[model samples]
Target chain A: MDIVILLYKGFTALDVVGPYEVLSRLPNAVVKFVAKQKGIIESEYSSMKMVATHTLEEIENADILMIPGSTTAFLNVVKDAETLHHVQRIDATTQWTISVCSGAVLLAAAGLLKGKAATTHWGLLDMLSKFGANPVAERYIQHGKIITAAGVSAGIDMALYLTKAVAGEAYAKMVQLIIEYYPEPPINISDFSAVPKEVEEAARAFFKKEMMKMNIAAAAMN
Target chain B: MDIVILLYKGFTALDVVGPYEVLSRLPNAVVKFVAKQKGIIESEYSSMKMVATHTLEEIENADILMIPGSTTAFLNVVKDAETLHHVQRIDATTQWTISVCSGAVLLAAAGLLKGKAATTHWGLLDMLSKFGANPVAERYIQHGKIITAAGVSAGIDMALYLTKAVAGEAYAKMVQLIIEYYPEPPINISDFSAVPKEVEEAARAFFKKEMMKMNIAAAAMN
Candidate 1:
């Protein structure tokens, strides 16, 4: 099976790595990291840099195509004509098309999430509706072959479900055992809705400021 | 704060990445991936390659030093006197020295875990005894400034605790909320001990075979 994970400047690391850790272990799986350009792709929130093995144009088909989200960088991706065209091109041939976190915005931007229930990073949940997607708050929602996971860490859960769908329950459980997928969060917050409203507002403001900065930087580059 | 994560050929992706996703977001945190060589480092089971930001020798001190695990590659790392010496040198200076999964084995081999209670991947818990370290099956255990986490995904939980220790509770919860880290595993297995004995045995056999293969490859290279 050929699995292609999309990458762009300022992409979130865990959004892709969490799913990669689980899905890459599938039998006969060959995973490729593809970006607009071949070489290093820096993350949005971390100093970590991953090497893109192939260019987006180079990969025309994938058994699975994964799109990982970013805080503000995804806005640029959603607005790019060439990238959206490629996402649509790949989606045309994939057996499974998945997005994590704000990545759903990119899929929804491409018209793939129209009339579909989807989920994304809590901060961006309402924005999905602007692109014709029904924003839900679940960990993950599968509408046909397109699976959209809630946030950064939700990709791990979504991948296990995808594994069960592609392979069998037995194989998925074995993979879970191999990774020791038992999660024990140390934080006291059980529900994101329960978080202080001020904190959520502050985070949203930070993201908005970041988007403005990204726009300035992009304009300067042009 | 300067955070240095050690990487090697065939290292597990999630062992380090899980923690990176959490810790890299700490206030004023700068996370660096370091290896013996400064270049692309490949994972044990995946085709993913990460760029090492600095060579091990270039970095002598870190506020936090993290060692991520590999299935068979860790055996090579433990056997190398130079690598063990570097680990010791870095551990001596770190405010916090940590390991994930079999990374505890590397710390143990370096004499840092001697007479200390630590934890590692469930399959290799007993191996810590060879280096005079006590192994437990908890998600993570901290002894003084050193923390050892169990298995792959445990690093996320361990990092949340470390965040609380360094930055306090409110900041940690904010970071947790930023990532939207509410985990919901799709697999039904709650406790690893409840897994069928055959499945665990099969996974162990697979690791052993991979270790043997790695040894043969090392011999050929030498």
Candidate 2:
């Protein structure tokens, strides 16, 4: 299976790597990181670099077309017509079209999620409506072949679901065992609304500062 | 804070990326990917290449020194004198020395886990005792300045625990929310032994075949 993961500058590492780590383990799975151009792609943090092995134009088809979201860079990619055209082209041949976090935004922007229910990162969940996509508050929602996960870490769960679909219950269990996917989070968050206002505000401010820092860095690079 | 992540050939991607995605969000965190020599570090699966920004010789100290594990390659790294020497040197300066999966094997091999209770991948848990470290079946165990997490996915939980320690509860909660870390696994395995015998065997065989394939590719490269 040719699993093509679309990459772009300033993409979030875990958004891609979370699912890549799981999906890459499937039997006979050939994973490719495809970008606008094949070369080094630095993450939004600018601390890690992953090599994109293929270009968007080079990978004509894929069994799985994965779109990973970024912190703020997703906004730019959503507005880029050429990237969306490539996404549409790749989706035409995919057995499964997957999105993680704000990646659903890209899919919605490409007109694939029009009138369909999808989900993304909590912060950007409502933003899907702007693209004619109904944002669901679930972990993931599948509309035929397109599966959209909630956010960054949710991709792992989404990929496991995909694995069971393609592989088997037994095989998926084995893969889960191999990764030791038993999650024991030290803290529990039952409700996001219940979180302290100060904490939520601080989190928002932190991301805003980070996006500004990344923008400054990107501007410097240009 | 200088957060140094040691990278090497044949290491598992998620074992490192899981913790990295969480820890990199810590306030004022400076994350660096270091290898024996600074360049492209191919994962065990050979599907991805992560650039190691710094060389082992160049980094003098780190506030948090993270050691990620590999599959069969951990055995080779555990036996490498120079690598162990570098790990020891780095550990001497770290406020927290952390390991994920068989990464504990590397820490134990470096004598950092001597007579200490630690955790690693379930498949390799017993091997820790051989290095004079007690192997616990828990998700993670912390001893003074050292923390060892159970398998690949467990590192995400372990890192959250560390995030709380460094940045406090509210900040860690913010990080968790940013990552949307509310996990909902599609399936659950309450007991490893209860899994069908065939499924367990298949998983083991799959890993063995993959390791051999990697060995063959490594030989070809040589």
Candidate 3:
């Protein structure tokens, strides 16, 4: 499988890293980090630098096309009509289009998810409808060739699900075991619903501004 | 705080990245990717290349020194006596030293965990006892200045705990919410005890050979 992952400035590293870890494990899978240019691109949150393997023009005939989300400048990039046009062109030829967190917003911005069901990070889920998508707030959602996962770390679930869908379940299970992905947390604070009211409120407040911007951007694109 | 994270060829991208996303969020925390040399280092599992910002010789007076785990070949680099000696020298000056997964083994080999309670990737937890550490099969273990987290993804939890311990609970909670780390998985297969017997057995079979090599390397270092 030839996978092309979009690496934009300010993307959440986990959003890209989680899926990359799983997809690259496939025996014959070829994963490419496609960016606006080839070289170092800095993520907004942590200032971690990722090296891009290929430029956007070099990526062609990919089995999977993935877009990872960011809290800072990713929305601005997706809102660019020219970039969205380029993504739309790529989506037309890709076998499967996948996204994590608000990356679904980019797919929706490209008019790929019109009238289709999709998902995004929970904080931004309600805004997905603005992009003409029937938003489903789940960890992982599959609507035909378009697959979206919720939040930053949920990309792992989406990747595993995609692995099962494209490769076999046996391969996906093997990858899961190899990564040792058993979720035993010391505290039960993983889900907003499970956490304290104050924690949830704080989280909502933290992301409210970004969600609003994404909502506005999705509407403008639609 | 000046934090230097060792970046080696074939290191697990998430093992470093998960903690990086959290640690870099701290106010006045300057995190640098320190490698043997400065340039791009390809991760073992994902093959994602990251650019190192500084060389090992450039790192001075680090408040925290972090080492991330990797696959077999990458893990072997840490076991090298010269590398261990360098790590030991750095550990002596750093206020706190930490490792994720088999990174603990490197600390042990450097004689940094001689009397510390430590842990590593659960699959290879048994090897820690050989390095004079009282190994615990937990997700995150902190014995004073030496902290160790279990396999690949657990680095995030360890980082959050460290953030709370150093910065304060409120700050860590804020960062956790911003990252939206409330994990809710459709499957409960993150640990050997939670996963199927067949899956556990298959993983053990696959990893046994690597674990044996780690044991031999640790013995040689001692």
Candidate 4:
């Protein structure tokens, strides 16, 4: 299996790695980190550097095409005609097309999520409707081969489900067993609804400020 | 704070990344991926390439030194004189010395876990005893400044707790909310003990075979 994960700055690193951990272990799996230009891409919140081993021009197709979510970077990618066009081109031939968290927003921006039941990060779930996507609050919603997962940490569960779909339940369960997919969160933070009102407000504020900054940066570059 | 995460070939990716999503958000946080060599190091299990931007020679001290775990890779690192020496040297100056999963095994191997209560991946919890470390099968056990978490996915929770220790409860909770860390595992995978006996047997068997392969590879190299 050839798993090609899209890499871009400002993406949530966990979204890429979570699914990568589960799917890269598939039999004869060869995972590649692909980006517009090769080199390192920084994670949004953490600013951790992840190297993109392949450029978009080098690899034209994927058995699985994964799009990881970002805070504001998703908007930049979606607005770019060439990148969005490339994503659409890949999705045309992909066996499985999936997006995690805000990545669904990008997928939706590419006209892929139109009329599809999809999900993204809880804080931004409502935004999906703007792009003609039916946003559900589930951890994952698999609407006919286009699997969309709810925010950051939800990607793991979504990947295991995808694994079951691709490689059977027994193999997926064994992979789960090996990784010991047990989670013990320090708080009861299941989704945006479960968080305090102040937290929700802060998240909204963060997103608004980030979007403004990204706009400024994009304008300055142009 | 300067947080240096030790990178090596065969280290578990999520074990390093999960906590990174939380800790890198700490106040004035500077995260660095450091290895013996300054370049890409593959995550042992999945072969995902993570770049090590800093070399062990370039960094002498860290406020927080993190050791991520592996399967048999931890054993190879434990036996490596220079790497163990560098870890011990760095630990001597660390305010917080921590490990995730089998990473604790590396700490124990370096004599840092001697007489210290720590934890590791649940299935291999007992293995810590050979190095004179008190293994506690909890999500994370913080004995003074030495903190260790149970298994792969447990690192995130441990880091949240670490954030509380380093910053405070409010800030930690805020970070938690930002990440939207509401985990919903498909299985009741709390720990090794919580798993069925057959699952444990299968895990053990899998580990045994991997070890055999690793040993064979080592012998072939010799």
Candidate 5:
């Protein structure tokens, strides 16, 4: 299976890396990172870089199409005409289209999630509707060929589900065993009330501030 | 807080990114990726690269020191005198010395984990004994300044714990909420019996075969 992951400057590394750890190890799975050009693509945090071996023009179709969202960079990416064009083109050719976190925004921008239920990072869930998507807060949503995962960490769960969809439950379980993905998060994140209201407010405030910064940057870029 | 993460060729990307996503958001936190030399460090699967901003010699101490392990490349890293010496040297001044997966082997090689309860990838748990580490098959272990996390995915949990330790519980909870780290894995990876025997056998065998290949490659490099 040719699993091509889209690489954009300032993309979140974990969104790609989490799924890569699971899908790359699949039997005969060929995972490729593709961007506008073949070179080093630095993630948004300025902490990590991923090599894109192929350009968007080089690969037109994939068995699995993965689009990872950046914490702040996704703002700029959605406005890139070439990128959305490629996403729209690839979505037409791919068997499965998967988006992580705010990556659903890009998919929605490409008109793939129009009149479909999808999920994105809880903090940025409101933005999905601006692109005409009915946002659902879930770990992952599988509606036909489209699979959208929530937040940065949900990519692993989404990928495992994708594995089960493509291969079988046994194969997906094998991949899970290899990663040893027994999660023990320190706090309950699913239920909003589980976290203190003040802390949650601070978290939302922080996200809003970052998104504002990203919006300004995106406006300048465009 | 100055958090320095060691980056070497063949290191796992998520191992560093997971911790980074948590720690970088800390109030007044500065995270740096350092290597033997400042350059692009490709991850184990060859899917991603991280830019090491500081040379190991330039950064002598860290508030928090993080080391990520490779499935095969860690063998070479454990034997690399400069890396072990740097690890030992930095550990002397750091408040917390942490290792993820086989990274504990590197820490053990640095003489930091002797008689310490450390953890690593389950497939190579027995090898921890060679480094004089009391291998514990747990998600994360904290023995004084030394902290070890099991496997690839466990790094996130370890980092959150570190966040709570460094910051307060409320701050850590805020960071957790920001990431929306709601994990819902498909299978139980903690208990070996939770999975099928043949799948477990395949996982073990696969790790063994890859280690053998890595062993050969390390021999050639040395």
Candidate 6:
């Protein structure tokens, strides 16, 4: 399997790293870190730098194309018309196209999620509809060739699901065991419904302001 | 807080990346990747390269020290007397020392886990005792200043737990929500006890052989 992962400045490190951890383990799988140019790339939050393996022009064949979200000034790079055009072109030829967290917004901008059910980082869900996608506030949403994972860490689930689909159950299970991904969270507040009223309200308010700013910026890009 | 993460060739990428995703998010945290030298570090399984930020000689004033495991031939690098001696010296001054997966074995070899309850990747738990640690096969184990996570992905849980301890519950919860760490496995086969007998046996056989080889290598190094 030939996998191409999009790497942009300020990209959320985990959104890509979590899935990369799983997908790169597949037998005979070739994972490439694809960016505009091959060199050092900075993470969205941390000052950490990751090296890209291939430039976008170097990628001619890909079974799966993944885009991971970023924060801070990195998000602006995704809004660039030239970059979105490139993503749209590559995604058009890929067998499976996936996005993690707010990366779904970029997919939507590329017209990949139009009229399709998709999801993103919780606070960023509403913007999906603006790009003609039906936003689903779920951990992961699979619509035919497009797979979108909610928020940052949900990329692991999407990767596992894709691994099972592409490599079979036995292979997926083996990888899962290696990762030891049996989650037992100390708090049961994974969803808004399960969280305290105050916590929920605070989260909602924080997202409301942030999402509005992102929406405005996304619109200006258009 | 100043954090130094050990970056060795053949180290498991997620073992470091998972915790990095969490700990780097802390408001005042300064995370540095410390290696024998600064350059591309290879992952154990995927053979992917991760860039290291600093050299061991440059490491000083670390509040937390983390060791991540790998399965590459590069394991020979850590076996050097100078490297192990440096690890022992720095570990003595760190406030909190931690390891993920087989990394705990390195800590134990350095005499850091002596008389401490620790854990490692389930497949290699039995070997922890060889390094003088009371090996506990839990997903995440914490005995005083030493914290060890099981296998590869459990580092995420351990990182969250550490975040809660240092930054408080509210901050940790906020980070969790941002990452959307609500795990829902499609299959119930994460634990050895939960998996089918055949699958479990197959995994044990595969890992046992690898562990034996690692044991011999580790013994020679010590």
What's the TM for model 1?
Answer: 0.94
lDDT of 1: 0.88
List model 1 lDDT by residue over A1-222, tens digit each: 999999999999999899999899788899999999998889885468888999999997999999999878888898799999999999999999999999999999999999999999987887899899999999999999999998899999999999999988878877888788887888767778778777676566666667677664423211
Q: Cα deviation in Å at residue A31, candidate 4?
A: 1.3
Chain B global fold similarity (TM-score) for predicted model 5 against the true chain B? 0.93
- What is the DockQ (computed on Cα atoms) for candidate 3? 0.49
Which ranges in model 2 have alpha carbons more than 4 Å from their true place? A191-194, A211-222, B190-197, B211-222
Kindly list the per-residue Cα lDDT of model 6 for residues A117-201, writing each as its tens digit: 9998877787788889999988898999999999888999889988888888887887788788887665556575565666555
**Per-model TM-score (chain A alone):** 0.92, 0.92, 0.90, 0.90, 0.93, 0.89
Clashing pairs in 6: A10-A44, B10-B70, B11-B70, B12-B69
Task: Quote each prediction's TM-score.
Answer: 0.94, 0.94, 0.88, 0.92, 0.94, 0.91
How does model 3 fare in lDDT?
0.78
Question: After TM-score superposition, what is the CA distance of residue A157 in candidate 5 from its true location, in Å?
Answer: 0.6
User: DockQ values for all predictions?
Assistant: 0.68, 0.65, 0.49, 0.56, 0.62, 0.53
lDDT tens per residue, model 2, A13-95 = 88998899889988889999999998789988787989899989998899999999988888889889999999999999999
Task: Give lDDT tens digits, candidate 6, residues B1-222.
Answer: 888898877777788888888888776789898888897776665435677889888876588898887643324643667767767877877878888888888888788888999998776677678778898889888998889988888888888888888888877777677678777766667466776666666566555555567664433322
**Candidate 2 per-residue lDDT over residues B1-222, each given as its tens digit:** 999999999888999889999999988899999989998889887768899999999999999999999777887897799989999999999999999998999999999998999999877787898899988898899999999999899999999999999989988888888888878888777546556788777767766765576563322111
Candidate 3, residues B1-222, lDDT tens digits: the string is 888898888788888888888788776888888887898888874448998888887765688899898766445775577667768777878877889888888888788888788988776676688879889888889888888988887888888888888887777777776666766544456565666677666656656655575565433222
Error of 5 at A220 (Å): 17
Which pairs clash (backbone N, Cα, C closer than 3 Å) in model 4?
A189-B182, B10-B44, B121-B151
Q: If the candidates were sorted by their DockQ against the true structure, best first, what order would they fall in?
A: 1, 2, 5, 4, 6, 3
Query: Please, what are the lDDT tens digits per residue for candidate 4 over residues B137-175?
Result: 788889988999887778889999999889887677777
The segments of candidate 1 whose C-alpha lies over 4 angstroms from its true place after superposition are A215-222, B215-222
Number of the top DockQ candidate? 1
Error of 6 at A55 (Å): 0.2
List, residue by residue over B110-178, the lDDT tens digit for candidate 1. 999999999998878888988999988898999999999998999999999999999987778777887
Give model 3's share of reference contacts: 0.43
Q: How far off is residue A178 in model 4, in Å? A: 1.8
